[model samples]
Target chain A: GQQVMQIPQYQHVQEGEDFTTYCNSSTTLSNIQWYKQRPGGHPVFLIQLVKSGEVKKQKRLTFQFGEAKKNSSLHITATQTTDVGTYFCAGPLKSGYALNFGKGTSLLVTP
Target chain B: EAEVAQSPRYKITEKSQAVAFWCDPISGHATLYWYRQILGQGPELLVQFQDESVVDDSQLPKDRFSAERLKGVDSTLKIQPAELGDSAMYLCASSFGEDSVYGYTFGSGTRLTVV
Candidate 1:
């Protein structure tokens, strides 16, 4: 069974602070996807990374896939109140049907 | 921007009662999935359907839970004789394709509480 683990189960920061969440997998993954869930809301797709050592950015958010494709990271620069939510990373195992999701990093940005 | 739709955003029932939730994915989407999210936890896949056929249901509690996507469109998830531990948010999502890269569009989810 494949499993994904995320570090820093919870993080709280003041506005204008930076936050980062790390995700690691027990098995190599073909691709990794990131999602964000607002408080009391369903998860929303953010981005996906396929290539090893790949890096992608959306505004102040930066995503990185490890060179081995077994880990990933999501970093937010100058967090805002709107960035408050749980961030999750998911990747497919060999089967490729259902994705294995990390426990998620809950971020809290205080103004 | 089409999004997945789910009904009965919240439900409260006594133990041993039967409960059902409905989900309608974005039109033209080929894959649908049902996930459960306990409080303070991430969503866990319960079942996945490729159109009208189930592709995976290993995590589903088949003894008490069942799901169907008949007609390759809307779907339903039912839990019979629900227990107190069944309290959680049931989420439905759909993807344009089965690939992980395509990601999924998720519905608001149904929060169930079995008292």
Candidate 2:
């Protein structure tokens, strides 16, 4: 079974600082999706990366896909308290259509 | 924006009792999925449905867990003789297609606590 792995299980940063989380997969992925879940809330779609070596941005956040499509990263600039949440990276399973999610990186921003 | 809908935002049941959760995906979505998430952990796939037919349930504990989407519009998940370990958040999601490249819309989820 394919597995998605994420680094920095937890992160605490000061407001205005930067934060980054990395994700890796045991097998090549056709695409990678990122999600954010606030405390006591459901996961919400953030973005998706499909092309190798792809890089996409949304405001202060950046997403990158490895050339091999087995790794991805999300970086946030000037983190704010509103950025507090768990960030998850998911990939489609090799056997089926369901997505396999990483343990996720929980971000905490302090003033 | 369309959203997936789930019922009984929270549930508390005694060990060995039965519990059930319900979900209704966004209209016209063809793919639905059920996932379980323990506190401080990522969501794990429990089962997936393409229309009313189950596409996968390999990760589900069939001995105690059962799910159905009889009419292909709404779905239900049941746990019989729930154990303390069964306590977790059950999430339901829907997508416009079978491939997740289309992204997913998740419901609020049901938080189950087995005492």
Candidate 3:
């Protein structure tokens, strides 16, 4: 079975600080997607990386996919309170269409 | 923006009791998935449906868990004899495609607690 693992289970940062979370997959992935889940809320789609050595940016956030297609990272610049949540990275299952999600990195930004 | 609809934002049941959750995905979306999230963890896929047919259920506990999307529009998940360990957030998500090529749209989810 494929497994997606995330580093830094929890992070607490002051407002205006930067934050980053890393994700690694046990097997090569066709693609990887990132999601953000607010406290007590459902996961929301953030971005998807399909190409090897890809990098995409959205506002203050940046996402990178490794050349091997087995690792990814999300970095947020100048974090704000609204950025507080758990970030998860998911990859497609080897045997099916379902996704295998990493444990997630919980972010807490304080004012 | 269309949304996935889920019923009963929360639920609490006595151990050994039965509980059910419902979900309605966005219109015309052909892929639906049910996932369970334990506290402080990522969502784990319970089942997946393509149209009205099930594509995966390997992680679902068949002994006490069941799910169906009979008409390929809305779906239901049932847990019989729920146990304390069954406490978790049950999420339903839908995507326009069968794979992660298109990201998922998730419902608010049903938080369940078994006492």
TM-score of chain A, predicted model 2, versus the true chain A, to 2 decimals: 0.96
- Candidate 3 off by > 4 Å: none
Residue B93 in model 2: lDDT: 96
Chain B TM per candidate, please? 0.96, 0.97, 0.97
CA lDDT, candidate 3, residue B57: 93
lDDT (tens digit, per residue) of candidate 3 on B1-115: 8999999899999999999999999998999999999999999999999999999899899999999999999999999989999999999999987555669999999999999
Flag regions of model 2 displaced more than 4 Å.
Answer: none
Residue runs of model 1 more than 4 Å from their true location after superposition = none
In TM-score terms, candidate 3 sits at: 0.97
Quality of model 1 by C-alpha lDDT: 0.92
For residues B1-115, write the lDDT of model 2, one tens digit per residue.
7889999999999999999999999999988999999999999999999999999899999999999999999999999989999999999999986555668999999999999
Kindly list the per-residue Cα lDDT of model 1 for residues B1-115, writing each as its tens digit: 7889999999999999999999999999989999999988888899999999999999999999999998999999999989999999999999976565669899999999999
